[model samples]
Target chain A: MQRKLISGIIGILIALLIGALIMLVQGYNPIQTYAALFNFSLFGFYPLATTLRNSVPLILTGLSASVAFASGPVNLGQPGQLLIGALFATVGGLYLDLPAFLLIPVLILLSMLGGALWSGVAAMLRKWFNMDEFITTLMLNMIADFFTYWAISYPFFDRSAYSPMTPQINTNGWLPIWGEFNSNVIVMVLAFFVIYLVFNRLTAGYEWRITGHNSLFARLGGIKIDKNYVTVMLVTGALAGLAGGLVVMAGPHRFLKGLGANYAWDGVMIAVVANNGLIGTLLYGLFFSALQTGSLGMELITAVPREFIQVLQAVTVLVIVAGRGYLDILIDKTIARQKARERAT
Target chain B: MNIITGLINGMISGATPILLAALGGTFTFYAGVFNIAMEGMMLTGAFFAVLGSYYFDSWLMGIVCAIIGSLMMALIFILFAVTLKTDEFVTGIALNLFALGATTYMMRQIFNVKGAFSNPGIVPIPRIHIPLLAKIPILGNILSGQNLIIYITVLVVILSAFIIFKTRFGLRLRAAGYNAPSLDSSGVSSAKIRIWSLIICGVLCGLAGAFLSLGYVTLFSENMSAGRGWISLAAVILVNGNPWGIALISLLFGFTDGLGLLLQQYMPSQFTSMVPYVATLIALYFYSIQARKRKA
Candidate 1:
């Protein structure tokens, strides 16, 4: 934990350095711009609220990726899964006639099923035919885009609406919004504990770890590698789908195309940054959400582009990727220099 | 225009970038690294090529800029993946995001443009019509009048096949993927081979990117590679990382995309647009099933 914290701090500093350089190149005062962003995200309630809302999909997607990464498949298809979830959830909201409370939960669960089924496609391919899940999942993202595009542009497209999105769920089905943050944040918090329990208190967690570390070793140890891959993907896909569902039922209230745009990739980054820990992933998601929300103001107040946060986010991931190995190389260089000094003296 | 001719032309245009990117991807795959950064490198290449042509008014200079831009990205990948031994996926994915954001920011800052830019001053890559081939009527009509890069891709595919099968360097590169320890013990330095192959991949991807912006579209747009990088990776997987296989699969995917364009008049544009990607997934599934069958 100490090592991770130290690396995290180092990683943030490197990201900041890159962010500052970009600001400088763009002729903005880096310190002032960063201060403004932080001021909005940390002090103001509205910005913080926006941050919480923006993090909903990310937190879920981060959890999704954390599980997949732990179970040996690095799923890059979470966005597709999320979209599948959102698409179906919207369909359920429109067609299903149920009481508000029951219908909302059913829609959320259906979204989870949608995501799971989509990921199952990738997992099944991996299991039955010995395909690599990494590439398959990425390929599925594109396919999912088409699926959602078709759903919106043809079947679910709202005739009265100008954009390619489904009509809003009846107000009864909508999760009551709590100020700027949606009620889904509550469910997201609940999910954090549930995921922690699943990872720590279940035998399946052990199986997942073994498979992730080495399939050959896992099989020799009597773990069902194929089953574990399929299960993790299902759970991962469910979480991803629920994220999209939450956006529909609680936030956007519509099945908008491009729902969770880039959030799937962002989730992967958060998982890596958080080192795949459930609670850590949520914390990283919040941090990213704050940056994303605050960057909007930064663009208006300063000349910094909102997309610059994306650059910072990517740089942060890169620094974390360069973590322990990078420090070891640095220490080795230092030690070599000291030994050379001793020899000369 | 004949529907057949238009569909074939669209297919060639659509497939050219994937073909070049996959051919570029072949090197890194042989060297044991999944070059997921191909998308970003290609995107960077596209942006720099446009900038190159926009400023220099010369296609040659544009290509040069693209190569330099993509090579820098490749070197960054080498640093993280090879030198630091970082998680290749994280580095690759981050580099991709960085490239996307950086290019968009630069496009806004330098060009005073948002989303896309097309400057009339920029020169496109020339189209070549081989003299003898032009005389062959139907065949010439179908094959001729392609961007110079398309013909170059044909040569690159054949050359890569020969290099992979017959050359010492190619053998070592493959050994890096299949048996790195033995190659290392043989004093071949797998890291060195990995680095060099990635550099070559970068150059080829650079050319591919340039082709996308200059040859096909004559414009640079935000995320204009439009997941072609991922499609190219699928091509790599579909072929199980072989040069000739990459070529054939790329053409097949290209045709699928062209068919999507042609079928737009019949079906909903959204559904028709899915042809290439849906085909990619199916192709991967069938390829893996075939592998399993052969093994059994």
Candidate 2:
């Protein structure tokens, strides 16, 4: 655990160094850019709130990726699932005539259902037809993208709006806010708590870990790997769907084109960089969110493109993954040298 | 007759890039690597192709620059997945993200463009004028006046078949996939074989990218490769790296794509744009069923 943590830190430092180099090459001051980024996004009251708000979807998506990874299938359908979920939430908010308390829960549930249904298709394809979920989910993402675009463009488009977007949901469906914080942050926190408990304390989590580590071993241990796979996929889908739902209820209050943005991909990267651990995913998700929110400020102040953050994030993942092997070699060398010195003594 | 000719011509052009990338992916697939970074490589190639063409005023230089860019991406994949022994899937995902970011960043920095970059100075690949083929009625109309790369893709498909089946390197490549340790014990380094395959994959993807920016269109757009790289990946998976099977699948996909373009005159483009992806999913479903039956 200590070694892993050390390597992760080293990986991050290396990534930052590389980012600095790139900025320097582009005739910007990396130190000043980073300072302004953190100060603008993290130190201020409003900026911190915005960072937290942005992190809500990321936390959910990161957990979604974690759950799927823990169950053996690489579910790359988070974006599609998120969009479907948001679409369902929008439909429910628009058509359902109910009190605030009743309607909000319904919208959330509908969103989860939408996400689950979308991911279920990929799960079913894998289970029945022996299709690889990786490719199927990717294809499903493209389909969902165009399908949702068509849906809002023709069927649900807000005629008064200047851009492509669905009609705004009833205000009752909006997530409650206290000060600058959306109640969706509560949802994110609850999700992390539940996932943490399920992973660390539940027997089902044990089965999933076994399954992901080795299906043959899990089967020999009398676990139903197929059932676990389906259950985990559904759970992950719901989590991702909830993220989409929250994005609508908390911020946009409507389904906008390109609303999914890069959250799903960033979430996947977080899960990978965290080594698929729930706690690690939360921490990394928040860090990535800070960078994301901060990038805007940095861009404004330094005339640096915010896209540099993406390059930084990706390099960080690469370094973390690749640094592990080299770190192991170094550790082994240190131990060997210590043993030789002990013999001499 | 004219419509049919146009459809056939569009199909070939649509399939050329996918075919090129899949041909490259076939090598990596046979070498025991699941290279999902072809999309990124192709995107990088597309961006650099435009950049090179705009600066050098030559399409040939654009192709060279694209190959170099794609090779660099492939090198990153190899370094992590092969040398460092990390998960290839993770490495591929990271590389794809890197390519997207780097390309977008460079586009802004170099051209001050946000969504896309185009200029009159950019030279597109010229079409080949086969006078003899042009005089041959419907066949002539379908085959003549195509982009130069389309013809090269045909030659590449044949050449790939020969390389995979008839060469000693092909034998080692397959061996690397099936049993790398055994191949290692037999004195040939499977890692070396995998590296070479990825290099070849990179080159093919480069050509595929060049085709997209310079041949298929005259400019580069953000994420312009779209899902063709993924479609190429599906083709590779469906055919299990058979060059001819890949070509057949690419043609089918291209046909769907071309049909989608044609149908856009009658339907909303969003619906029309979905034709190829939906078709790919259906094809994959049926292909998996057939494979299952054969196994049984």
Best by lDDT: 2
Kindly report the TM-score of the first chain in candidate 1.
0.92
DockQ of 2: 0.81
Instruction: Provide the lDDT at B171 for model 2.
Output: 94
Model 1 local distance difference test score = 0.86
lDDT of 1 by residue, B140-241 (tens): 877888898888888888888888889999999899988899999999999999999899899989999999999998999999998899889989877778
Q: Model 1 in CAPRI terms: which quality?
A: medium
- TM-score, every prediction: 0.94, 0.97
Candidate 2 regions with alpha-carbon error over 4 angstroms: A332-345
Candidate 1 runs further than 4 Å off: A328-345
- Per-residue alpha-carbon lDDT of candidate 1 for residues A1-345, written as tens digits (9 for 90 to 100): 776778888888888988898788768899989988887786778777778878888999999999888778878789889989888788898888898889988998989999999999888888877777787787788778887888887788899988888888877779877667677888788777888888878899888877888889999999987778789989999999988888888877888867768888899889987878777798889998888888888888887777778878988888876975687678789999999999999
Which run of 10 residues does model 1 chain B get worst, by summed lDDT? Answer: B134-143
Candidate 2 residue pairs in clash (backbone atoms < 3 Å): none
